[model samples]
Target: MESTTALDPATALEPATALESATALEPATALESATAPESTRTTESSTRATVHRPAGPVAPTDAAAVALRPLAGRAVRLDPDGFLGRWQRRNATETLPHCVTNLERDGALDNLRHAARGERQRFSGKWFADSDVYKTLEAAAWWLGHADDGRLTELLDEVADVLAAAQREDGYLNSWFQLMDPEHRWMNLAVGHELYCAGHLLQAAVAAIRGGVGPRLVEVATRLADLLVDRFGGDGRLGICGHPEIETALVEFFRCTGNRAYLELAAGMVELRGRGWLAEHSVDTGLGGSSFGAAYYLDHMPVREAGAATGHAVRQLYLEAGVVDVAVETGDRSLLAASERIWEDLFATKTYLTGAHGSRHRDESIGDRYELPPDRAYAETCAAIASFQWNWRLLLATGRARYADELERVLYNAIAASTAVDGRHFFYSNPLQLRVDHDGTEEDAARRQAWYKCACCPPNLARLLASLDAYLASSGPDGIQLHLYSAATIATWIGDSPVELRVDTEYPWRGRIAVAVASTAAAGSWELALRVPGWCDRTPTVTVNDEPMDAEASDGYLRLRRAWREGDTVVLDLPMPARLVTPHPHLDAVRGSVAITRGPLVYCLEQVDLPDGVRLDDLRVDPAAAPIPVAIAGLLDVPVGVVAHGFVEPDGEQALYDTRERPPHARRPIDVLTIPYFRWANREPGAMRVWLPTA
Candidate 1:
């Protein structure tokens, strides 16, 4: 595999330089410098420079030898009128509060309270219950910055106080460890998840501080970090977290506080992986049966040596995310190279058509290469979210458009499909094919449910959607690049001048995107690059000021550079023709099958859309014929569905074993209807298939 280092670093925006220049221009004596124009305003400190001025909290501070930089969350705001806008609003108004209620109902809050009181009784729910509360708190913190909800603020503060009070003097804070069994604390390193929960707490603390929610959580996180460093750093202890999460969180904590110790500890943890530490301390007990060995926890080989994705899908992805963070902050090119190799291997074999990963229902592990079985898929919602997180870090580290493309695919399909339209219920496992009359366990229900005992996917989806704006656009020294098309207003800097751009479009349903320059400084000139999706076969046409203009394309983007004026409009037209897609021949399950996709949304045939007397299993799609587009009303709240021509092959043999060759099969024309994969099972639970055999 080629090393990621081979890619040119110049393509990525040099945030450190941009931030340093902004800081240097300010006169020390001028008090107004602090409130200078957004373009000229430097970050709080010159030593800690941010890439794009984030509209949200949690900006990355200056680190050595980083690749790409992210735009400030505050610089971009959704228009509240686009496809993403509706989802964001739902996440804020409904999902955030609903998650809190579930947490309270599930005893997450009660466990914290009980632990704070030094109770010896076991807490309800899983061993990772405290982490769920912290995740919900993290989502709420981000939402507080986007929307003003006084009641939510009160809830956040109350939760923070309870968590702070629950912490031990030594900074240890795991409810399961305190309330369930104190003697077993840190003893079960193979699956204890102590550091994993700490990672979530640290992330929640960072979110709180950055969103202006509070500082108490920051203090709590710092004490916990100090405790971790004292325990794991240097010769004190050499074992890393069985679950890989704290490494990334510790790096963020270092960024927020400008503490080198935290950064060092994060790097140390990454280095400690693949060292047989877990194997040395392995005990024969955990969630999965006897198969839950060292490899299942990703301890079989070192991170850099492991060529393909393995073990638990979420754990591996989270570990890779932390590896990418360490590589960027510490300039570990070898580590980055390892991550790139793993990414290539994952896409080549492990990933599913819906951009979902993990195939083993037994342990939520990534099955063998090309071992994707649709009927028994264990594509957990948390794994999909983790894949998105890892891809986002890779995009920031490499400035590669492919990373953004994969992230977009996962977000639109796997992540979006995990939740219901109302944002209340969720799917813990998203399978491409759901058989009729299938008996599902609690976690693998055929339809979305209000809540689950494990309940990780609901809050995880909420947090990702609440912070979705940050993943839309990115800025560099040359100009701003819009990764995902959305209706939003961006307030960012082009060099030293402030540039405000308003984007208008009904994306994913239409192909046209219109971007207008709302405001800009006098004589400002910067290149505005728009991404041309890899799936688009037709050349995108661009027009400036309503007149067609020739544009240059490079590295998956069309570069438009010129001085801008108010009311100037640049329009890009991407053809939205529905196309049929097929998997590699090596994929035995879907070898001769094909799937249809329009725009970024993957379409699937659902039982609710099929005509009566026609079962989904007996149908075969005609790949040669064009699918008829039909406008359907009130189908999973989607506006349209596709009708494809196919044939049904009914079995004639009544005997279980047909020794003689079956008579010539009769083919009859049938109309097969498909809705967006994410919208499946919203109406009723039945059979659904993403890939159909061609007749």
Candidate 2:
């Protein structure tokens, strides 16, 4: 595999058939295609897919898959009847939503035609144009499902035609797959984006099929996914994707087509864990004691040993979803425990008030435990959504309230803030503090872009937001657990019995809740539980039918095991108080950094709130200092300690000075307001610090 002077045989061919021949040519081609071709693609009719549309049928072909669209609008592949059923069924009451939406819109669909046309003008090639338009169509499919955008279908057809023309006879479809070394197929799982692109295609195909897809694109994505399974499955030479989406996508694919091979492939791909096979072939760091060394710990996971998350946010979320797959399929306590450890580790230390994770903005990866400085939080919107998705699975697996509690916080703050009023603009990085300038950090642009070096967040957010309906469902045989308290009627099965549950309450306001259950089970015994978040007010008091009852909480869930009538009502109360949370004694970042908490919301300090953009290292604030919540502009505003007054010297601009750390310094008392880092959205963004300085 070493190259010295001569060209590698793989790159020599116009069309590469193997990996060995392309390794050498890749070095040469990397320079020529710093930019890759448009990823839009189409394949011959031979590509196999469960969704068989008449060659020209360009609208909701399979009604069921497309029927349960999210409120955002678009067909999604989410159903609880099949295997790999969604644990967070509450997330998808309308459809199987993905993160991307019209997050840019001021909240209306009218601007899309104008916006799509405007953004289309910004792209260079047709392929790129189509994907950008595809995202618009994807969003258009979900949010504007009823709006007749025949132009979108036409645009998609043209893009498919382009891909059909661009694809070589050998079956590779990535715009960047062989851009440089065409022969390097199936090699370099790290950094290579083919699989991630496949996840997008899968999502896009769901939308296309719903919006009406040409047979060509459907066949293209199906073939690509199948090829992925054939190569990466345990028996196959290729291993799991460096990124995690493929596993989740393939699971959905199995549900859509009832193809056992897809499920088997998912199992095979996951089974390859702990073996250093994939990393060994590529430029990966192989396995590691820390999550950072591996590709988000795909090298060793529930597919292997349950390990803590260490790498990129997206990879961790994807891998966690895959692990959920393993845990449910095999009922392995080992995998379940691993997920618990990860959850406990994050909640006990790293999670932001806004439920954001990851500290380093540059890498979008989780930093050391409790190293969650608000100024540096890289909590991407998709990461928060994915984290909630993972937590939802954990809740269903273990029936733990902590998981559901965490999911609720992220869903309300970080995940929901991702979309704008119109639902098109998205906040990529959900920080803990506010800044004054536009940033280079990830996830800032509100609308979809043609491409970014790291483009995972856009489609990921799109897919999650689009499929939001699939996340909200009732599962397990015992009974349904009303984890969230929204006033909605959700119908799901809890055995052969169809359970229609009605929730009536304004949560996060009055902890008081009323659950109306409608089901007939012959007066038998069943346990219907409700989640009690950590922020509950003074040992929650619950009554079953307006009478005082002993509904004790054990392990964060209030378990009620008594027979009741169909019309019986259960009322529970939770108290929300403005409290303060300190860091673990051993952690350096949050030691002085005290977070203000009211219910699930966490608060922090912003450098913008400080003078001269103070570098948020460590502060010397007293541990006894208490912040107070004040009424501001009709919202709760926490008045934290005033920023210590300090003045810049005469020569503050000088790189190095002879005397002290700057000049005529003056003490200024600055009024600093604080809120959850995730809520610091839609502003000129930059770095923020969650931990504060204790005097």
Give the top-scoring candidate (lDDT). Answer: 1
lDDT values for all models:
0.77, 0.51
Taking the tens digit of each residue's C-alpha lDDT, what string does model 1 give over 1-695? Answer: 11111112233211111111222211221212212233332222222222222234334554545444566555666767667877898899888889899999889999999987888875889888888888888888777767678987888888878878899998889998788777767667777788999999888877775566756776777788888877877745756878888988887777766666777888887777877787676453443223587777788888878798899999999999889888888888899999999999998899998889999998899988899988788999999999998988887788788888898899889988988888898989889888877899887888899888987888888877888877788776668889898777777666666667778776776667888887777486788888888788788788999899775558878889888887898998786666789888788878899898987889999887777877888899989987654555655666546667899987666478868877887879987777889988788678889988888
lDDT of 1 at 404: 83
In the order shown, the candidates' Cα RMSDs to the true structure are 8.3, 17.0
**Runs of candidate 1 exceeding 4 Å displacement:** 1-58, 64-67, 282-290, 654-656
Question: Alpha carbon lDDT of residue 267, candidate 1?
Answer: 87
Model 2 CA deviation exceeding 4 Å by range: 1-171, 178-181, 203-219, 233-236, 283-303, 331-333, 336-353, 417-424, 434-453, 494-496, 517-526, 561-567, 604-677, 681-695
Q: Global CA lDDT of candidate 2, please? A: 0.51
